[model samples]
Target: MAKNSGRGRKSGGPSSRPTKPLWRRIVRSVFIWGAALGLLGAIFLATAVLFTMRELPSYSALKSSQNGQMIVVRARDGTELVSLGPSYGRWLSYDQIPQVMRDAMVTVEDRRFREHIGVDPIGMLRAVKVRFERGHFREGASTITQQLARNIFLNNSYSWTRKAREAVLALALERKFSKDQILELYLNKVYFGGGAYGIDAASRKFFGHPATGLTTPEAAIIAGLVKAPSNYSPTADMQAAIGRGNVVLGLMAKNGVISQDEADAIDLSQVKVAKEEGQNSVRYFTDWALPQLDLLLPETNEPIEVWTTLDPAMQKAATAAIDNNVPKGTQGALVSLDRDGGVLAMVGGTDYVSSNYNRATNAVRQPGSAWKLFVYMAALEAGYTPSDRVVDEPVTIDGWSPQNSGRSYAGEIDVRTAFAYSKNTIAAQLGNEVGFGTVASMARRFGITTAINTQPAMVLGTSEVRVIDMTRAFAEVSAGGTSVEPYGITKVTTTNGEVLYQHKSVQGQVLVPHYVAAGITDMLQTTVATGTGRAAQIGRPVAGKTGTTSSNKDGWFLGFSSGITTGVWMGRDDAKAVRGLSGGHAPARAFADYMKVAVAKRPVEEFDTKLQLPEWQLEPDDEQLQGDPDDYYYTDENGNLVHPGTGTQYDEQPRYDDGAVGPGPGPGIPQVPDYGQQNGAMPPPAANDDFLNRATGRGTAQDPGLRPGQGTGVVPRPSPSPVRTSGAY
Candidate 1:
């Protein structure tokens, strides 16, 4: 009876099995798989969403950095002379970019850039496919927003961990910044050709025009080169660039930016090759003023304009001086600052494009006789008169024999005459008379923060000092004894016009009286009138000094007018000597060329007469100096053992008087204990670590222990880690 209930099944068949409808079996299997998959998907979705929410940095809550934006310095004439960056990069606003250039960039780099939310799924899928097929990392799927996130917030590291971090950051960026704003930053900061970073620099390099003024064809050229700068460089390979330009045009056409007819009609053959030229920007000006920026603008991570005291005319003149007067193959640096410590102009090196090493602010080389200002100031403060007699004679101290390069001897002369003539023997004797420590102290007071060894030999400028420091010291002298810390920025404001930081002049007393500083000025003027600095003389009154280190390794000319102070240095990257060259030869000549062009444009002026010092009576010597309680005595520059309290005795003979003789024992110097001298034996000479911190008087002997920013310890983490938990599992 049960078997008959079913269709025409046999009795054995019905007892053996019961059959279900095909549709029902399919439905059951579908239900089971669907439920399992839905549960798995729900769990994965929840975990991914939660993890992302937890790890992602707050978009609106991201605390602005202390170094939020860069500060750009404009000269008095309204020319952009320099810029200081949070990380050596500049950020521009959306409106600052040309609309056409912006459009072209989007068209060539990402057609769907404006429509996506930081990432493009289609592009991502294609990238994944390409990567799989190539069996390696392939084309990027990151949109402009994603790139902005990676470049601005996350560090570049190729790892799943880093990629996850970038993804989180991309999400945050999309929430924080507007599409136009993100694209503006990306265009402004993207790497293009050579070492040039940013569309602005690339525009100037490839099209010989500013980003704002780029033409359609020129913009196409720049846009095309961005994909693979080295491969499609107009200067490196014109054929490759043309081919790339065609590709960009095709992409633009494909994106409906222009009709195919228009694209085909565009003259690819008319694309002019770009020439590779040295950077004409003011790289030196930026470097020389970096220290002042660190001091005055503690918080600089925001967009702001810095109105500087720079004279564009002076900058051009200084650059010309290096190019026109310096010998071929001679590399150098020059800096100019106002009496208020505002940098006016600078030439960091022969060419900023060829080398990024800034010699004006970073190079530390001996200044030779140029450092005599400090020595003489110490002598004058110690009660020595300019008319006092001193001898230029061969001498030795502490088993070290210093020799004058000129090699001839000059008899006793007045202090003023000795200095005017740059007599090494007289300088050494004066430095000895006053404690070498006194010289170092005087230099520090005037703002030379670099460590000057306390040894007597330092009088000849054995320690290395940067040109920027030298220029600032001279600015103090020009300001009539008030030391103004050199500064590059004036004000920093946010995009919404909130004042983040401002720099008022930093003032301090470095010299005792205007007379002391004036005396030094007058001495420097004499150097220009009839001494080594004669070449630096301008029709308007000027004062300066020339210097050459041993073996002619470094050359320098530093000077100042009533309103401006300048320092110029010339040498090789490896510190190799320039043959037959001295500060007076190329350095002074360069100064002269610059002054000739600069002085004509500036109003003629002299220092404030009100700051003039009153004439004072000269005393023979301090009789109050008492003998050392201990029996310790030391040899002076003349190799004569002197009692601790006894002043150095001057002889009438001088050393190496203007090459009349071969090198002789150098002028006498007092035996001052060397603070930097190694214990037991001399330690290895310190390597120049300018790259570590060339600016920010952060490591001067003033604080045997110092670092940038005030903190207990630990370098602060930059931004925040965007990497998070795996979403795949």
Candidate 2:
């Protein structure tokens, strides 16, 4: 029993050796296993580092690689118009960079940037701990060097392998270059959104100044963009950018880079963010010129200088004219073409940023009465003079009865007078007489490529046509019947002074007879002087046509001087009619406004008007015509009927009024004498020949001046000769 007590005491009591507790044993095993795994992880990371370093780019390659330089567009005088590329400004050095910018960058991007060789282990561990506590990876611990490594050498793909490669590259970069050199390279290559790369370009683009002139707050704002440039763009969102800048300022103070008092002194209100000038103003012209680039430079990586024909002053004037004249919510486009078809200015729409659909070049709409130029040209080509008389009365063709806008008819008028009033009835009648096919052919001859219909309605300007084509056609007319193909680019050269391409002017074909063109110009002069296009007069002898569609959906005024031919179109894009809008109103007014400024420097030149007209076709004496009744009807030397009442002559009977009643002989004019057997008896109808001769105003077939019923047994006592008006006579 004593031996058993001794053994129990030895087992239960404190002895020389004591068994370890379960918790402590488990802890020891875990520690040992953890240490082993940690060693293995370290070995794996080192091996990865070795492998990645082997595949890394050489330092020389990194130093030589550069972002693409901008392709600068220039004016004819070599003035820079705009830049197109990734980097738009000069490179900035570390010393050129503002100290506040450097501090803000280092504080917000990497606090231990100076202390870390490349990767910050403390930052990484902290990131890992925070991520683990939050149950997911939500924070980044990449040092500035790591970011530089990725940006310069690797793509921004998230993966352990990529991250390991980035770490290796960063480490190699640290050993290869000093911290200042790395930071300089990073600052020079970092993208600051808005197609702006590098601190210099970002500074210039946002503040309109160099990076060396950045204020403390501006530097903070720029540095804050390192994380998300687009979200913190000063031009895009000022409040968000300022808030981010305040955060960066706080970080700078906390990191001992700046004093708290310095940060507190920064008033957010005093931070004047630079306003970026909208680059979309030239978008239309640039878009039109883009296709020419391939022909200009087939293969070039260096910056190429493009000399364009765009006149900035005229462009501004055109834009302002449309903006001021056209009603709100309605769009407008103006295109100015010089004598050689160089596009001096183009405003495709009111706001290019809102809609890039180039109305000037792409949109096709009906030209309304503006299309009458083609119709009248066709008539002239078909042997109808501008002085030819056409009765302006309602008529129907192919079951389509077209009427005048106001339903008021000027019974008989000359073509010139008809066109001046934009008489739709007369135009339709002329189109019918000349044939729709002939009118369409004339339009095609004038450089109109848009499909034209041969229907009677087409004579009233019912077809859709592009504004550019219309302008080109008018340019042809202005060039005295010579065709013009619109072109913009003049020359392109590389930065190394190598001429890539140069424009060669091509002579266009003559599309109209010179005399006919001059006659047309003379007629159009009357349009601007006292006609529908009166509003388009530019204080000089200007000629154009006013076109208002049937429902006033589209308004257009295509005019030209000797120097330039411009076309203005105003309407809604969706084809909705703008109430009270007409070609003679807004479009004509806009044209005048644009031309007033456009021709300020150009010498005033009159149109060529040497076409001869018969003496009888000249403007009638207004005093004698109202008093003398015999001067109303006569024949000119060319056998054309000269009518003083209508201020025109005709080679044939007015076609539409052939069967209508005519006014009897006027006062002091000879009357048809009665020749019936009885003195006052009605007579039977005469033979067809005699009756036809009398009806056509020719002498009766029997005798030269015999009465209508002389031989017949009919006594026509001049049925109370109806009151004769000038229109009827």
Give the top-scoring candidate (TM-score). Answer: 2
On lDDT, the candidate that comes out on top is 2
User: Compared with the true structure, what per-residue lDDT tens digits does model 2 show for residues 197-250?
Assistant: 788889988888888888888888899888898688876667778898899989
Where is model 1 poorest over a 10-residue stretch in terms of lDDT? 720-729
lDDT per residue as tens, model 1, 1-729: 456556765576556787899999999999999999999977875566456656655532332222234566677665676554433133445787777678778987777787887778888888899989999756678777777667666655578887766766665566656787668667866767654567777776666666777666667778887778768877656777788888887887888877889878888768654565545637556545544655655534447766556677777888888887666677888887777777677788777655546777777888988899899888766655444456666755556555655676666555666777787766777777677898999888877877789887888888889998998887777777787776666664554767656667665765657656756666676677777788887776777888888888888899886577888888877887778778888898888787677656578775432213233332111221112213334445654445554554434233334557434445562233333546453422222333123222344233211112211121211111122111100
Worst 10-residue stretch by lDDT in candidate 2?
711-720
Show the colliding residue pairs in model 2: 683-714
TM-score of 2: 0.54
State residue 384's C-alpha deviation in candidate 2, in Å. Answer: 1.5
> Each candidate's TM vs. the true structure?
0.53, 0.54
lDDT of 2 at 205: 82
